[model samples]
Target: MKVLITGATGTIGSAILRHCLQEPSITSIVALSRRALPQDISSPKLSTILVSDFANYDAALLSKIASADAAIWAMGTTDANHEVNVIYPHTFFTTFLDARKNSEHRSKRFRYIRINGAFTVSDQDRSLWFFSEPRKLHGMSEARTLELGKQYRDVCQTFVVKPGGVATSGAGVMECAGKLFGDGAVIGAETLGAFVADLVVHGEEEEGAIFNKRMVEKGSALLKGNK
Candidate 1:
């Protein structure tokens, strides 16, 4: 199997790449990022493509994707300030769906996994008002989740991982504070990576499904037991 990973340098994304590289079934990998890949996990089967533009993707990228069987998209910005939170998540989901639609390897059914928030649901309205608006923006997240779920319904096998809070060895002090104080729990990136590898190799059906952190942890255990 060949895989394409976007935002391959992120905490969770990097973990997935590391685990996939060690999988004998994964013959090749293409990483898309704004900068060159870090040398920490270099391998012959892995290649990196630098891309800064997300809205207008270059057709040349299809060559790399042509050899891939799946894509793990981990590109999302955390800037909830301004209109970033509203825009970035929706854009990220659409880009992956659009890219799959235009790929030359359409013959190969592509499996796409995206990192989403745990609270995002498929149903509910979000038209609230006042200073409490930002707190209620979860409806925006949920709507985006449902939008992506619908867009990729039959086009690709989609998996939405709703992680609570990702824990990485390199996490900064601010992240640590949130992990300790926020309404979140720590989930190791390695565990998340392992699940990604299993999903790629096993070809599990997660289309329109939302797997929260606890669900993911339990699912991983169940998969391991079945294996």
Candidate 2:
């Protein structure tokens, strides 16, 4: 399966990229970035596309990525603002669907995986103490994607993965703090990467929102299944 992935150069995105490279089931990978991927990474199965703007996609860009069976929006950062969190993904959601409009004959079910945080509150009226703005923005972003997924159920499916305490290699302090606070469970980058990769290659029957608890449970299971 060919997979289109954004933010393939970031931390979580790198983790996801590493696992996608290792998965034999995935035939090819298309990485979207503002710059080229690091020199350390290279593979015949991988191709990188330099994109200047995330909010807008030219016909050439859309056409290039339209063939992908799945897309993983692994973009966004800790201090991600409204444009990065909402506008980018929203634009992408609509643009990708437009990209595939011409290819209806060759269309297969497109699985779109969105990486979201666990504490995100979809309820706009609900109160949050910490990271309220970011959480709400992300929540709002996912809400819109879910709506599109429902609307295009025939041709596409969207799944939001709410992973908690993404413990990356050597990030002791951050990992520890993450685990101790919000989510007690710490999921390593490798495991989380493998988890999402499995979903795109094997495909999931259902889609919506997946919390940290389910992520840990299913991610672990998916990793083992890979072995």
Candidate 3:
């Protein structure tokens, strides 16, 4: 199976790419990026497409993306790069729709897993609302993601991954502190990456499914059985 991965250079996106490379069943991988990919990660099964603007892609590129069996949309702006809460979703949705429109595989289900934090729609719980304060921009950014999820719930499947604090490879002091406190909620980058790959390659019946870190890992394993 061929898969397209956007934002293939980012931490989480790269992790997913690495995991996909190790999967023998995956035939080829197309990575869409603005710049050249790292040389160290090159492989025979991989191809890279340099894209200037993901929000708008030319016809040629669009057609290519449209034909792919599936795409993992991972492009996003961090707080340091862009005013995430206000602008990230606009760019994200525009790119997502463009990808869908360009996809050649008509029935090909696009599995979009948005990385967001824990949030509830209910306002009755004021305590939870505070949790969204410090991360207001991030929270608002995810709201737009949810909007996209609802919009494409019928045409395509969208799942939001709400990880509290991501724990990377080296257990830094911050990560250790988090682990010590009740706020130690975190998912390793590699773990999250493998989880998404398992979902895409082996799980199609999981369409329109929303999953957490734990659920992603579990659902991926379970879906393989039925498939």
The C-alpha RMSD of each candidate to the native structure, in angstroms, is 5.3, 2.7, 5.0
**Model 2 ranges with Cα > 4 A deviation:** 104-106, 170-185, 224-227
Candidate whose TM-score is highest: 2
In the range 8-82, model 2's lDDT, one tens digit per residue, is 988889889888999898889999899999988889999999989999999888877878888899998766488
Instruction: Determine the C-alpha RMSD for candidate 3 after optimal superposition of all C-alphas.
Output: 5.0
Distance from true location, Cα of 78 in model 2, Å? 2.1
lDDT of each: 0.64, 0.80, 0.62
Writing each residue's lDDT as its tens digit, candidate 1 over 1-227 gives 88888768878788889889988899998887889888887999999888776544555765545556777777655433324345544564566557766666556666767665554433335543533343345445645666666766666676766665676653344334544665344455665677777777776644554554444454347446654
TM-score of each: 0.72, 0.89, 0.71
Ranking by TM-score: 2, 1, 3
Highest lDDT among the candidates is held by which one? 2
Report the backbone clash tally of model 2: 0
